[model samples]
Target: MVAEEKTEGQAAPELAAETAGRRMVVLEDFKPVAFLDDDDRASAVRRYSTLFVVDGRTRKGGLGRVLYAENAWGDRLAVKVLTAEEGADLTEEEQQALASRREAAFRREYESSRLLTGIAGFPTLFGQGRIDGQPALIMEWVEGQTLEEARRRLSVDDDGRLSPLVAAAIGRDLFDLLSRMELVDGGLVHRDISPSNVMIRTQRASVEEQAAQGKFDLVLVDFGSTVLPARASSLTVRYGAPQGATPDYAAPEMLTADVARVADMRKSPAVDVYAAASVVYLLLCGRPPFQLGGSSTGGEGAEVASDYLRKTTELPLPVRAAHGESADVTVALDREGEAVAAVRKALADERLSPSNQDLKEALVCVDKRVGEVVLAALEPDQRHRPSAAEMREGLAGFVEAYPANVVAALQGEPLFQDWSFDERRKAGGFEARRRAGARLARWAAVVVALGLGCAAAALCSGVRVTAVGSLPCSLEWGFPLVAALALAPAAAGYLVRWRGGRKRSGLVRGSVALAVVAVAVEAFVLSATVDPAAMKGLLGAAPLACSSAAWCGMVLEYSMSAPSAWATAKRPAQGVSGKGGSV
Candidate 1:
């Protein structure tokens, strides 16, 4: 019986080992199925039974269909498939060329996304395979609204414009992502970076919760038209073709006929920079830099594109009318017309002789420095435009230099609002100073109480003085100086409270200055009042009183200002915690 029980125990261990080994084998064999042909659909499903199509056609457009799917583990993914039926009306040669372009675009997108994997602000590519004889790329599903949708949802101002702070933040994040992309393999230009391609991932919660959650992140997507170093020539070679650019956001060089075959135009990072500026402009105003008036079809479409191309090539970039401009003045420019001819001419002349003041006038609502950077990027001459790195630096500087609370308020972002409030509290403006003043008042009262206590002690001790130097003196004579010394900090505190412009350091300096003056005055008063017999003691007491007053003043100042100092020291740690805890 004992032997049989031992054998059963040993068999239990062996069974457990067998189960774990089988689990490992199953995990190792797991592979994502690929649907290569229409006929292979059923086999693909059988192989990838764990992956279920949530929505077969989530979105269908001229490009193809976007299929939303999820695996058994509940991990979601998006698959872009180019169906053959999309371009069936075309000739065989046209069909072949179209297929070639589609495949190249899909492969390029996959490669670009793969290269940019692990980047915070770029999408991740999963894998690629053929779906029903057509190429398809699978990418990690990003959950967020596009910048275009977000912008549309924003509450616009009376002038039909988004807040400048919101626009600047968007520009800052977009350029930062572009800068990161450029860091890879010398540089990578996102040939298409429009509003629709940028996604904003923010928490869907109440303002307070959102602020506490602090999750406002931007991601760049759709790299189908990315220009790598090796593919730079492809842009020039494509020439009159669409070049995969929206007419509204395309650079002047991209639209100019003279630069159609220019290799320099294709090689520069200025193309992406120009598109970024255009996106910023769109964010600031409700319209693009060059608004396409008519539908993109037939004669009207050709006319509209031609007109936009001509304006982009010839005319200076137009600014939206200031918020309170008269209806007549606003209506003067056709959406497609050289409507703001005078303003355009002025801007063009300013561009020729650029000045800080002119740039300020050209773009209202946005910071003048940001306007200068954008305008420089939009320069008609591709050679003159700033590099992507330079533009990114400019935008970053603008974001950093602006007041955090103001920017947060304009953005209407809860997390930023909370951060802004904390920053403002740390900065210590008028309200902070007022609070410091109240604390100072309480400190002054305590100092006064101590001084009175010291005077009572002196009286009780019966300390007396007869004569010092050439003057006679008594305990009463020293009392006034003692009282003055004790009250000095209160006076300084009052001055700080009333003056309103001085900082904590300034208050400290003021207190020290008052101490010095009080010491000098005490010396003169003692010299004038005390006789030679009492001079030594009186003189000794004068220095003590002055030093005590100075020390008291410093203590009061520090006490009043310590909260701000403590807040500043603690802020970075708090921020780190907030970020870590946030979504």
Candidate 2:
């Protein structure tokens, strides 16, 4: 009733001939299609006299085909046609049944579009009709590239990731939209929230204004798979109604066909929360946090299934058995329930592959609070996930912390603003890089202290008494004694560093011990062969030795721990801090 009824004797509508292996319904240009007035059964019908198809604008999806078109008055629009060719191997009766199912889905999409008529960020419905005996729905043509394209562009510089600030901004926008959907009567759930289903559109402003503001709008498209909570039982809970979602982004509850759990979750916003957080995670970490167990052999659904079992139990279903097979209802439901529970528990415990701990470490490198908010949204237990409003508030904190001008500039091509690992290191955010610098500075200071200590020791011992008015000096005791003196400062520095609560590396302690023992042995041999009176010169070097030792101790302690200590200065009281006191 949403479209005009077909009348007998209407000439066979023009349709493009089907190409081999491509299930597309490419319509010829200038084909006439009829759209009914908004009233469900309005007798008045608006016939599109000259609908011209835009070349190179056709997009094929599993459910249907989308294409761009214009009418007689040159009003541009997007047309979605419910047409797909069943496998050639199917009998005529099977093909007819499949066609009927697709037609029903098409009508449901039209109903969803009508329900979402006034929501911001959603497409405006133009009309609905039949073309060449296939169902078609026309809507406002949104001009923009898919989020997938934007993500790909931003990932060019950072191992397939975007900056934390950028991801936060986008995430805020998505949650804001989801919050709006929650307010809709009966509540709506976008079961499919993949990157391709989102659009990034620049505002209709001048190029100069765009460059100045760098603002972009996010649009949630593809309502065909969207569902209202009340109607979910008739769809997903019904056996044989395949879940309409990309396996990678689908939540754990959605991975299995557990009727009770799936039915109960239909109204929960947490389902979309998991998906949105996964998208944000993908942007931040360059990969999904969970690895599909049997992805190599079975599809993603099976991989998630195997991933769940592998985490929860020693034995897992064979890739083939999990893939799909005709089974009795009782057995199937039991399997589905177990899988759903296992996945939920595994995810709740943060036991999935590429563990949450690792993800947190990676995220903390960028911004700790941002990581906290994202992980909370990814909480496996629905009760733990923050409400939509809470998620928006959490993300808004970091998004607002960023300068508007910088965000605008970064949104442009080439991503003028970036937060790669090297850039973060330069900003003093990378712990490893800071540690490397500290190590170099510490070693250099130790070497300098050693050289100075040896020189001072040599100067003190080389002086000698001589005939009245003649100044006399001797260099004979310098080699062995000075060598011992140099090792003394290094050993003292190591002790001070170790005493400051710094865990000493084996290498540092070993090097200091080896140098001291070796130098002491040589000094003893030389002293046994030389004058015993030369040892008296050491008394004169006492002040210099003490001062050099103090300096070495301070330098080594501070330099060795400065990197981590300085980075965590603003952290909580219980956080790890530098135990080495400042000079």
Candidate 3:
């Protein structure tokens, strides 16, 4: 009813591919082996630090193969490959462009896969490398049943329904992770978390122990499809306005299906909440709320039409109509008792979540084992989400309090993060380059100045200076060149910086420009002066300008750390070590 019924809008991204002959980095360690076995034929496997078998087809029917590697300790993990083969069928120029893209994709995957190992409830990275020369990263093999499988087992129809309580626990746990992620790292977004990503294990809770205990582990996998950007719209790729996760589990924003028109898809952490809510809905009712078509594993639409958008409602089957699998949702989303179009829009449009109350009440109906402490985290506002450490603590405490009746969710939090590691690293790298450039620029100025002096002493003496109308100005030919020399660095630094990131603030940019201006002016006046001794003295001070720029760079380096000892540490290093170190 929302239009554009298909969940995934665009076609899947093309696989990267190149010809055998043009591939400069040839497959060196080519070997062969079988998948599940004692005996097998020689299947050409690309080997570097690991093995690459780009057979393409996967167990789930995906377009990739397993990358095997052993780390320093020789621990093995599976790196799910995203093939370049989709591009193999392209033209020459396209192939060349794809080579660069594949490299970036590899780097992004490696870095993101490595970073995610820090968060809780995620897979671990064993190793990564170029096998047969193609880049790959090895990681832990998550062995469990996807939530989709669990849904099929529990749901009355393929339109999986989950009780609200189960949905809340899922929501709370995910929110907790997101908060920790915000504080820890900011580079990777698990862009493709769907029912398939959520692994579920079932345990028997007998009739006597109706609400006895539920113990389970949820592992989020498949970084292969992740959007590994420094920053992105939490709304779009991860979550559409209503639906941040996947269309099936997507919130109302995703339901509306209007967001496709907006080129720059952007959303927030709550974007995931919608999908999270959908997951909760599935857990409570054994099926998702809205039924666009069916479970993403490929179910028919009419059966899953009941996968209602969050806080949305259709017809709750009467108690008389109830069967073992039949369930009801009083999740009448609008206080206004709005019309069909309005409700659809609300479910599909970007929601302005003011509080967690709505999501919280929805969860209360599911299970009692869920803690209020964790539920307290399900607030619609992202900042309010409990930190991963805090969530871990809460989940741990709940188990301690309700040991007999509760089981843990995920075993450990990912160590891949704690704070903005990428941000800090990027900021540090930028500051270092700028300082080095400024230093080099300053060194260049000095070299040019010394060169001019040497040239003047040796070459200019013979070149007759026709005394102009003003004899005083005749002595100033060297001054113009000095200004040009000194100004170039800051200019070049600015030029080198096409666009400043969070680290390069306006104040810093302006300050660097001013330092360049001030130095150039002073160098010009000093170089052209009539008094030779004054020029020598002033030239010695010119290095101070370089030192000044270097000091600013150091301050930026330390400032990103927000260090109290920065001022004390900065002056000694930048001004002293590299001040005249290069010049």
Candidate 4:
């Protein structure tokens, strides 16, 4: 029998007698829940026979235990349960406060998941229920390694860092996801957006197929610390605020004690924006922006957290105080002081700042625009950081400006070089400029060669000695031979360079035609007033000289420009596949 739906006023169903005291319950007859789809509801019913815990006692932020389990049908799931046992040892008041906070956080997560249903890159929610008096949430199993793991595997160097292009791509996807989430619910804030919470799933299909499916390879997970601005005010006032963000990834505002009172802290998309930029920074540099003095791992967790919090809140001090002209200085500073001053100066300089320097060195192979966008997003002040939409647009612009082949190479795709030469053209990128410069130089050389040929021909043929009236020497066949010698090389060079090309053939034909017209004009004038033999020789020699010079111009142009074209054409073949593994 299909289970009846519960009204808003009704309480959640209680466990059966046999499952009453157990932390994990296997319902005897699963009922259809409003939150779950028909297929999942049916699957839950058929597979509700048993729930075996595969991993034991996985805890996050000290709030609850995450139990990894598989149902009877072998479908894996993650069940988060907030138990009262955590505060069992505490006094009445402390226990009550803790319980209230946990309940509020659990409810906030459940509601956010329900509202975020059908959103791509978000885990699907099955249902919510009570398990042994504790609130339990069952979420669909997302199969993939966390971005943290992916980052480790994709690290390019000894320092474990991501390439600039890869980092930008990941950042773009993350911001796009945040933008969509904000649009869906204006008040939604993903309080925790760290590397461990982002899943990087690899798809079997090609990139085009994945785009067609409207699915992204990156997925955001673990919304346990999500907050809704409208509901957070009441929840915080009643249960005290929930502090569950990763210290290294938390925004400065979030770390402050007055976070509860700060209106911007509660609902600002800037919170997620800050954390997302931190994630990208971590990927690009292999460490958080503010690295603790000591080790990040081991028993120094509290120390590392404290150090990170302090750095984010305060500006670092310089090595030495500013010098005063009137101050009595008998004691000179030591070598350490000088070194400190240098360090301070370097830090103050934008070009030499640790983050900028790191990005500059690491992204030498990437476009400069991409590095600028990433660094802008990493600005400590939230006001200075780009909005999620703006960040996405900046990265998208980089992708659009470059060719698909270049992008594919940056992404570490294998078939990148197999693309056609035309596909490698980038509108505003290096290759485009090179092509433009080459064309201009080629044309300039042709013009210069043609002009020189015309001048030489006119002088050698002795066509005229006067400025106005035509004057001619005795008819001579030697002038024709001289013209042929000067023009033939140019014509031959043009033919060789532009062989099998229509444009080359057109240029050659045009030059020959122009030469013929000049000869005919000269012959008409000279024949009317001078020797017909000399006019004929001048005509034949002038055309030959011009044609030869045009061909030589083609040779000069080719010599000057062909190297760059060959270099650009050969770049695609040295694909970036060997740099990083397949995308």
Candidate 5:
């Protein structure tokens, strides 16, 4: 007998009792639930039974409930079972149709699992079976949160956007997965590629080692919407065009209004390409490339309906149409030209703009090339979008540019590259500029303070210039003049730089001033009389002069070497790569 459904927060013993005696009926060769042929109907299908028990808690998703279960062999599994609305009435025919639909969905997912079993980034399937009269799939239980959950944990910026560097890494993994999918039987399209469908798990060896290397594995799941292109025509006729895909991430082509006209076009891998780009865009900026009415205020259903309308009846008027250039506007343009025009108009939609400034700031951490690639992938026309393989190639360059140090910084719990010189200033790139300005000010202040202190000491020591090339050096006149010359260069240079003079000009002026001071000091020391007492006085003056000059030169060098204007505006490439796909 079937056990009664257990409510949430039930006692452990009660939960165990609820799962007792559940038999999983596994078929050796599964057949389609609908349109079963004679061969499928006549055979006594080979089958087996496995006793499995649900343990711990249950997790819910859009289409099903997932619970942790262990088979008779004590191997853990994630069993996804169909979920029905609590209260609904249906006629006999309606009930059977729903049952057939549910069964077909289960079979489709099972087939996809089998097809993708050996592919990296996907979980291995155990088998498909029935539990309490509901279809369930037994697959490897991945241990980690969904990518959506990971975002909240990994958000390290002032705004909640994930670092574009990290997002690019994730996007690269996604494109790699898609590229591998293309190799299977002339390519498979995972029509649904949303955050909730991707799992983020640590490939834990040693936490320290992995953090140092900056490695984590992303596993793609929920393959029920997977489509094999060769069978697309039959599937379209049977199941309708533009099969189930998440609306927010779905491509413009996937949501076309006249499904019949684009049925052939739907078979291309471009749908997945668009969705992958949208996912990367969302990660970088915290919103999709396009949304209805400037936001998702009206909810998902409205957005889905609006997307269909936008791609069809409500598409923008062409450039020629608005200008009234011709009475017969459609006479000269071909299909490709119309597509190009439509794409241009679509790209101009304000809704397609990033919802926040986070994207611009995040762009500071990645190559401009990465941003270009992402924009190209989000193209409205499928022909304009690069293949998944191409995207992977474009991203390879920038992804390689992120140094191991940046990865190490990212791996710490804080999730920010605080140690990175570029990452530290990536938030609007203003902080670095501010710091640079402050450093210059501080250096100039130090130079002024030290020069005053040295000049005061020289005056108190009673060091006087004894002569000036055959003229007797006056005690009062020569000392003050020499002090002024030594101090004038740095002081004037600081003022000049502060007044917006070029750094190189200030450096040259300071160098000239220092040279004159050096020559004056050397001449005074050499002209000193042969008496030890007079030589001692001259020697003291030389030390004082050298100290001030050394300190000033140090400050000047630091100022001249300060980061340039470009450092604050554009990030240096941390890495390099051949041309390839971008985020």
Candidate 6:
């Protein structure tokens, strides 16, 4: 028989009884209800199953918070439970594998969450008892503002922006504390650092919360996804992107499953950086960075909306747009747009980063420690990424090294030779200029920061189109210095570049030059204007240094990319008579 849901005017139905170990199990089932508290004119109805669900929409765990809860003790205490049954019903082997997995997960939750002890406000482990019919574990109930809530309470301003200083401080406290758990005694990565797991309460009752047996002060709850022995090396495969990373927080690696397959998931920390950037974006912008404003959970809805807005909107990075002035104005529109786009790209995709200029600008407004913590995890190449152990050591150095001095030295560990440095420079003719430019770029950054005010604000004010072909040459020096210094071995690369390939005619050189000039100008203007000052700063006063240095290296990267020029141009030439009397 089809069961009917309860009506707004009806009382909650009592549950049917079933036998347990000794006691009885009852399930009243979830039903529909109407809210009476609303104004007389507001008519609203929702489904609620007495099977123990608390708040419906807000309570769901998609964002890492308690999603749906069952009230065991007259509804005062709520518990979130997920069972293997919820997944696709498995065959014998699948079921056994699933059972084994859940068992290990339950045990890990009990052990790690139990150890949170005095550090980091965490949920209290209540009791673990087998239900009469089903298996369930009980934990202390959490109440008050989630980080999202704090954002909302403080979000009265229509814009929903938090000061960079305030956002950074909050970010620092949370990360510095979280870093302490990188290895968590032996080896464990929180694996999931999205904002929903973080909670900041208005009332901090340390003693009371302890007395109540729940760690409720600025607590980070919901460790259901924490990595442990039985846990998969990557929670990202299942809980990432739409399910967890959410469009705004989802890293490029976490986005497409295809790219994910080719890349090193376990080694790439960009996944986490993407999440961290989203959090920073939300804290600073009020609205989550990439996700569109609304109840769009992680899904195509959020992805589509975020993309639309990102392409059209002027939302600046919290580091730049928060105060409205740190950014500059005279930079030109094309440049400003490019800069913003770069900042957006950094937050969305790790591969798009390595922007020193953008880094400097972001650091200026962002919390010094927050910047440090974020960088400690960002590297496009998996090999260059810091490990949890490395992160621990780096963090130790960070806290002890007078926070003021961290930025100048905080680059990801130098790229390995296998990464091939020199092959990147010879492509562009800016080899020597690239080196000179790197220093000046850093110097110009200080000047811009000190003398010009916020380059971001300058971007917001108006658009300034840069001249094509020839650049100021002074603005883009920083990138090449590192690439050149790093690739001194390839100093004679240009002389040897055409060594093997068909000799280049003036037309090919002109074509390549024109193409390079067009790309450089566009890249620079875009990079300088919209990308956060921090990101822009990294590019320095030059154009694509590393790529320019290693001509072969650059081509290799391009080779794997979509359709190439050589392939298209050479396709038609293949028809040119193979023999003397051919066609």
Question: Best candidate, TM-score-wise?
Answer: 2
For 306-365, candidate 1 gives per-residue lDDT tens digits of: 744665566545554332232332231222122123333433432333343333333333
lDDT of 5 by residue, 1-583 (tens): 3333222222112122343544342322333223445654333122112335444456764357877666446666677776652315566666666566555665677777778886778888756655555667777777777778876655443234454455666788889999998998878887778888888766454222222244447788887667788774322111223345666777766664445556556667998998888787776666666654423212344554677566334422211111022222232122113212322232233123332233222223333345555766776667656778767755654555433222222222222221232332253245446546656755665555456636644654555455655777555334555455444444544444453333566555555555565566556556653232544454535434544654454454556455555333433444211132121
Model 2's alpha-carbon lDDT is 0.53
Per-model TM values vs. the true structure: 0.51, 0.52, 0.39, 0.51, 0.51, 0.41
| Global lDDT scores for all candidate models | 0.52, 0.53, 0.39, 0.53, 0.54, 0.40
Query: Which ranges of candidate 1 are over 4 A from the true structure?
Result: 1-50, 60-62, 84-89, 158-160, 203-216, 232-240, 256-264, 293-312, 321-369, 404-583
lDDT of 4 by residue, 244-322 (tens): 5665676666544444455556467787887887787776666776655543212244554465467566542211111
Q: What tens-digit string does per-residue lDDT give for candidate 2 at 345-407?
A: 323343333333433332233254466667666555565566676676667655543332122
Q: Which 10 successive residues of model 3 have the least lDDT summed? A: 403-412
**Which runs of model 3 end up more than 4 angstroms from their true locations?**
1-63, 67-75, 85-103, 150-175, 200-213, 225-245, 251-267, 293-583
- lDDT digits (tens) for residues 465-504 of candidate 6: 2332354323333333333322322223322343322233
- Which TM-score value belongs to model 2? 0.52
Question: How does residue 235 of candidate 3 score in lDDT?
Answer: 28
Cα RMSD of all models vs. native, in order, equals: 22.2, 27.7, 19.3, 21.5, 26.0, 28.1
Worst 10 residues of 4 by lDDT: 318-327
Q: What's the TM for model 1?
A: 0.51
Q: Give residue 505's error in model 3 in angstroms.
A: 19
| Candidate 1: residue 365 lDDT (0-100) | 31
Q: Candidate 3 at 558: error in angstroms?
A: 28
